[model samples]
Target: MNLGTYLTRSARYWPDETVLVCGERTWSYRQLDCRTNQLAAALIGRGLRPGDAVASLAWNRGELVETEFALYKAGLMRAPVNARLGRGEITHILRYAPVRVLVFDAAHREDALAAIAAAGTDCLPVPLDDVPGDDVPGDDAPSDEIPAAGPVGVPYADLLAEGTGDPVAVEVDEDEPCVLNFTSGSTGALKAAVQTFGNRLANMRKQLMSDESRPRPGTRYLACGPITHATGMGLLAGVFGGSTTHVLPAWSPEAFLETVEKERITATFLVPAMLTMVLAHPGAADRDLSSLTSLRIGGAPIAPQRLREAVALFGPIVAQGYGLGETTSVVAGLTGQDIARAVTEDPELLQSCGRAAYDTEIRVVDEAGRELGPREVGEVIVRGPDCVREYWQEPELSAETFKDGWVHTGDLAWMREDGYLFLVDRKKDMIISGGFNIYCTEVEAALYEHPAVREACVVGVPDERWGEAVKAVVVTHEGRAVTPGELIEFCAGRLDRYKKPRSVEFVPELPHNRNGKLDRKAVREPYWADAARRVN
Candidate 1:
């Protein structure tokens, strides 16, 4: 079934049930379904056809959710742009996707218009400010003028009101593409990954069946991250299971906790860094987080100590998962039982990302793509229905990324005898010194064991003799100080001499990408600015 069918089914089963909650506003499934149908009829009235692309530049709100269902009903692919990106980046995605119509909320209207202008594409803009807001932002604010670009200009409300005489019936195949998600590439380009209806359905099924993935009706889901990423789309899985979503326009440690207490949020997904920020917030101690039942975290590995502290503060609700944009969301998850085992029995297992999902098959393979034995570190490859078949418009890269039937994740990991998978580091993040491969995560894990260290990122810097030397960027706890020599000594005691960082730089914090992963590209770009090749 298509992703849009979920709305129809929910509307049928629980028509009057509240489906979405944005701040003080709430939308029933019946209201949402009817409104989206009207919006779809509006899009059809404007000449949008099957397979046409509809892009939206907006934050998490009722309108954004409406546009998703509307585009699905219209049989058009929805391409949600990353609102955090600059105009140039947005322009590249729009040009690459070549969308037929673009929708922008009032907050992002200027950037969306700028991106369309830069791409030299004629797009019909739907001004969300003109729509009747209900307890959400712009509820009582004056309607702002939305600059017109195309001849057919209509307010979002007026278009919804002028519904078509009959809903146009369109054939939708389960394998048809429904969403286009763009990922940052190694060469600084955007790689659009097409998510099929079947892929999304498979993800929803897997998540709904998992014992640790339960979200009851009326459960409040807090979405604080960028909706363009995989985590953002994964939040929809919660909605599919009959939960209400609460959106945060932006990330703020104080606001995150306040919303949790105020909204009585039951579940949320955050990256490790964002979780750390929430824990460090002064208001966190004062907030009542007893309502939370599940806190799914991923995007990066969580330190053991940090995991312990999170469990201490939030109860045993924080679960970790491992996956990438190409996987359509989660491939492996550390469930509540796994968390309990790690905390009560074996603390070392807390560092692992647990086993593969029920629908996924994971294996560690060598350089020649040969399957490796347990405890042997190699490339982590996975094959499943949820995995993407190929990257859009890149035959060569697609061939290299997908071999045989497995999708090469480019992440180095090893499986234990108990079937748990432990992520070492990214293949590119491994530091090679005098032909010896050193995983950055190993060094960082050791560094985090230091009492004074709060966070650490390790990368290979250019060296004249060793080809590449280990370098670390560290963030210390408040009122704590660790000299470079002292940290180097700390690593020397726990790790091999070659694995120890030759230099250490203490900084306030490390830079993170939109998905909350360490921005190693940004960190290494400056050091290798004049280098001939990225590799020494």
Candidate 2:
């Protein structure tokens, strides 16, 4: 069955229910279903064939959501480009995927055009604001910066209006490629995870079955981040469960709190960094946050102390999920109740990303591909219907990552006797100083225990004596101060002396990637620039 059928069923059952909300504007199930059909019809009429690549370059907006469903209905692959990515990166992705149609927002007009020109691809450009028909009310006119569209470019509205309103029931294979989710380029080049239609449906099932994070009828899911990424993964299940997905046009801590109160947001997802900012915001506690039922944190490793603080403020509703682009959505999750138990009986469990999600198999394996025992650190691998079977257009890389039907997550972790998975660090992020392996996350977690430390990222730096020395870059809490020696002493008391940061660099703020996770690679580059190699 097509994933688009979920929206059609929702429309039939609850046509007047608002399924999408952006600011004061809202789109009912009927409106969204009808618009998607029209848009899909328009794309098909414009020569879009099954398996054609349809790319979207935009932020959190109603049109982006509509575009996703329309593409699903049309049986085309959806490739969403991160709006913050550079033109060179965008060009590489476009040339690699070889997109046939590019749908972009007015804000990304210049970048999209420049990337297309640089790539020299003959892709048809469609302005999202002009997608034919009045799918959204008061959608401001296209910005003057948008180029005049001749035959090569078509107004989005014109195309939608020309299409039929009847539902598009394109026969699509369940295993056909549905979405091409690109990994963050923090490590190196971006690679797309080839997620099939069945994989997406599996994602929905996993979320719906998980009692803690499941979406309920009339539940409002507030998505503060870009919906095209991790936040968007919940959209299908939220709709399937008759939930409303509220999108933020832009993100601000104050705006997010206000939206939660106004919309009575029942559930929401945010990266650990965003949660840190929100907790530190002066008005955060003052807001009426009682409506929030599930506050999920992921996209980065969060300090246990920070998790405790979030639980204190948000009550026991705090949950943490862990997954990758290759794994569609979260394959491991810690529920709010699990958090409460950890806080009371087993505080160590708070450090875990929770057990394998329902129907998923999680394994911690050594270099020889042998499953490691409890407390033994090794590569974390997962297998299930939600896990992508391959990477798009990269057979060699695919074989290496997807071996024996398990997706090698490239993450280092250990599983407890009780099945909880505790992340140590990324394999590439591990530091070897003086022939001793030190996970940067362990050092960073200790730094966060200090009340003065707001955020910290630990990396390995060059050293003559130790080869590679442990270094810490940190942001102090407001109106607080902590010197390098003091922090080193602090970590020394809590951790092994070798694991302590030899030096600490204080910054007003730490760098984060597009997904709001700490950008450790960016921090390590400058220090290792003159070194012979990154490792000792």
Output the worst ten-in-a-row residue range by lDDT, candidate 2. Answer: 130-139
Q: How many clashing pairs does model 1 include?
A: 0
Listed in order, each prediction's TM-score against the native is 0.92, 0.95
Candidate 1 lDDT over 1-536, as tens digits, reads 34666777777888888887665678988888788888888888878776678888766666778788777677778888876666788888778875888877766666767677788876776667633332344322223454545533455777788775343335578677778878877787888777776777787777887776666587888887765565466545655777777777667798789899988988888888898788777678778999998898888887777777788889988899988767888899898778867998998798799899988999999999898998999999998888887787789888988788788999999999988999998888888999999988888888888889888888998888888999999999888888999999999998998899999999898988766778877777678888766693
CA lDDT for candidate 1: 0.79
Q: Per-residue CA lDDT of candidate 2, range 1-536, in tens?
A: 68898989989989999999986679999999999999999989988887788898876788889989998889899999987787778888889995988888766666678778878887887776732222324333334353545543776787779788899978789899999999853347899999999999999999899877788676899998889999888989988888899998787798889899988999999998889889999988889999898999988899899998998899999999999999998999899999988878899998899999998999999999999999999999999998999988889889989998899999999999999999999998999889999999888888989999999999999998888899999998889977899999999999999899988999888788877888888898899998886572
lDDT of 1 at 495: 90
Error of 2 at 261 (Å): 1.1
What's model 2's overall lDDT?
0.87
